[model samples]
Target: MDGCALLPVNSPGHLPSHHEVTRFHCHSDSEDEYVIIELEDLENLSVAPDKRSSFEPGSNSAEATAQELCRAFRKYWLQTDSAVQLSDCLSSSKQRSVRKEEIPRELESSLNLAEEIKIISKLRGSSGWSPPRSQIIFNIHPSVKRDAVVAAQNFTCVGCGTPIESKYIRRLRYCDYLGKYFCDCCHSYAQSSIPARILSKWDFKKYYVCNFSKHLLDSIWQHPIFNVSCINKTLYTKSKEMDRVREAQEQLFHLKKLLKTCRFAESVLKEFEQVPSHLTEELHLFSLDDLVKIKRGQLLPLLKDILKSSTSHVDGCELCQAKGFICEFCQSADLLFPYQTAKCKRCPECKTCFHKACFKYGGCPKCLRISARRTLSETPSLVPQ
Candidate 1:
């Protein structure tokens, strides 16, 4: 019999192999009097295949035992003659006979026929067996278009290009305009990152469209900033524009607060004064116009010097130092100073010099006032690194 016909929770009593058969039972009866049945787990059986088949051909006692058991089943169920030839031996009736034939040899002499029948019933009940349903039902969404989302994301994930499998492919939900099939991970990224933009602009009603647009935009826009090939200059320009907007907004906010406190503006000035001499000299040219008034010129230079000093003091690159370049870092080549003929500004410890681009990218060779004060106050230091 096909293994698929044998369900997990319930199985037919017919042994799937020539292996030992333990228990049997009728599950469901049809109009034709043939009842579907299932066999119990074979592990509990005491019959030995080698011993049963090993019996001498003329062992009439074994055959007689089987016939007597057949008579019992016929009297109880089949209602047919016990003396008939074993014409239908291929049917499940053989299993009932198999059970009865083993009892006298396998059971202890103390156990009676009633006890053996009881044992068979108990084993039959305990063995997991059931009838196959005539009709199987699945409640999956008929028009759901399961792979719709995955196909929306594309065969490969939009967020991370993982190739989708067939099972998940059909199950994936599609977003038509996004033109991609979203795996769970990319789907979640689309949901969180994309929907957030939508939530900010509109409510949930247009979420699908907004989310799809957002996902599409991300797919189109996401690319590495600086690659040897395909540098994505358009994205780079937009990113810089965004950075300018953010920086301008922050400076406006900071300046507003600074305007409220003379001490704070004075601190900004003091920080500007602390810029190293070489950088100061290059920047001092802008301070020549005293005609603007000492305070106005001072403030402008102070702002310029602060930004320049911050960039210079913070950025360093390990890569440049390793390459024996003093005035530039390769990844941050934009930070390289325009005046290569000019003096070099090098970090004290790393002995590395950096251009404006390198300086901005290098993080910080020296701590700035905001973070320095924060670290010194919050963390305990053993001494110095």
Candidate 2:
């Protein structure tokens, strides 16, 4: 109750008294009500008697500089800390960006996906719900092909040109991900599941990877670079768990859109601090980290928990509830959101949500209208102009 007191009562579910709401508003509003509180705090600071002077000519240079910096910080915070745009607040932020190694200048750019990520991570963050999965190009090297085998054979280390002393004595380590050879110091016999093999062939076998490739993978483990819908649509049919997780992710995506747009849902967003951020920020994209979680059978449960909390917030917020969809098919009084998996089914073509039972009878009205419009446009006029 005390923590909830910080925010205004947009729609406190069962609160019966205006008195409590008034008290909370008074407590929070008290700061604003006392406009000179900050000034008074400065005046009342407990300065040592010896250091204090009754009539000081002016504040010292350090004090002036500190006041200026404080003002600037305050201005910046006020400008950015409102109901910010979804893009501005929800953009993908990775903890580390792989700095290109001088020895292997093309290490980060060796694969198309790697290069694309470098560009994206460097540029101003994208504003879309999820990056287009179709645009992600995976460069998986064929191991057995003659040309591929021949090209991979290098007399020197791929990292630093450290030549092999003897073929049998000190063999070079082959990195499956980069399809290159490295010396002992550069390789360290590190092994990890390759993203290329995972995305293209759905293979999860561990293989030897160079230190550079391992670090690179680790850095982008949580970056949304894979688009299973575009890359391997058949995987969903093959893996029921993946499909389920995808559906849950879609629901969370819809929920995030609502929570982000509602001006009264700021505290609700703060609740997401302890959870995986990718679930809310990117809709259709999956990170290597997410894939790992799915492999471990842990992603769905986590997503479900997130979904429960997010939906609860959207339902409780009056501003978010105002935007809820009324079932056009049955004309039901009940308000529906696309995230309500039990109640609503979203139209694949037009992306409209309706009660599942109602949809079974009426079909998608928007899709039918679109089809009719298309047919009318395609048909030629019988009479000449």
Candidate 3:
């Protein structure tokens, strides 16, 4: 009678059997409302505390009154349990929702709980619950889609073989030559952490220079030209070697322009024009007479040796001992000396010292010859007929 106390059959505490009818209060709060429930009606109700018997409330039988009371208790318990469970679920959902910030900006607006759960499942295995397929709307990037396809085949990072997941796919970077996808961490290390010696061996065309800017390309040509032997020994890939050679040729072309500005160099270049436009072909075809004249003539001192100076002296003359000859006009020691065997030239007219390489293309930067600019017909061809 008080606060959900169950009445047992044949107990002394219950209403005496002589009393055919008893008044039962459904709830403690309402003292005015009382239902007439009989002892037999209580006994007829099922044993389960929450289950309500089918006995109808409107029926004229004593069991009807008992059924009404049982139904009220059952409804109260069900509502209480549901409210508690829902509260717990909401708290858990809030915790899981915190990860939404990590999603890419492009996908943020369209993301939903169902799609999030699906992505989480893919990354960290299933959580034993799956939402309907129609609810999941994926609008991922092309790169992510490609990664997903690759992950389906390999199930791991292409570079390190770590298990591929949705999170990793979002941050992945690709290597074209390697033809594989790498994790973000590993890709970053490859770009900045690798040693220069090892990095030099990588294919410049395929891997390194693929994303080069115009400034970077020009810088390659502007930098001091490396020896062919050095480049050949260092670069293992054919593409890289070709890139080095091409850059070196471009640098040489620029150097030729500087040479043409001088009257003496202009004359030497005019002599060179008869051989061919390409320097490599002309070098191969040069006769012994040409070499003899180039070595001994005043023109030898004008050709700048662009090589860097070495600290130690090797076998040869003062120009060779200096490692590289300097150009007086440029006032920089960075000029290249092509002939290692040649000697330095001191101009008798100006008493200025010049490298053979510098004098060959152009006389001293200060001494311009009016005759050096004579018409091509007036200048005799250095090539033997």
In terms of lDDT, the best-performing candidate is: 2
- lDDT by candidate, in order shown: 0.32, 0.51, 0.32
What TM-score, over all chains together, does every model reach?
Answer: 0.17, 0.52, 0.18
TM-score winner, 2 or 3: 2
Taking the tens digit of each residue's C-alpha lDDT, what string does model 3 give over 345-385? 54556545566545644456555543455555598899999
Better model by lDDT: candidate 1 vs candidate 2:
2
lDDT for 93 in candidate 1 is 44
- Candidate 3, position 89, lDDT: 29
lDDT of 1 by residue, 277-341 (tens): 22222211111112122223333344455655333332343332233334434444333321221
Number of the candidate with higher lDDT, 2 or 3: 2
Per residue, candidate 2 scores C-alpha lDDT tens digits across 28-101 of 11211110001111211322223232212232422432243233323321122212332331121111112221
- CA shift at 357, candidate 2, in angstroms? 5.1
After superposition, the stretches of candidate 2 with alpha carbons farther than 4 Å from their true spots are 1-140, 145-154, 163-170, 201-205, 315-319, 341-352, 356-385
Better of 1 and 2 by TM-score: 2
Tell me how far candidate 3 lies from the true structure as C-alpha RMSD in angstroms: 38.0
Error of 2 at 377 (Å): 19
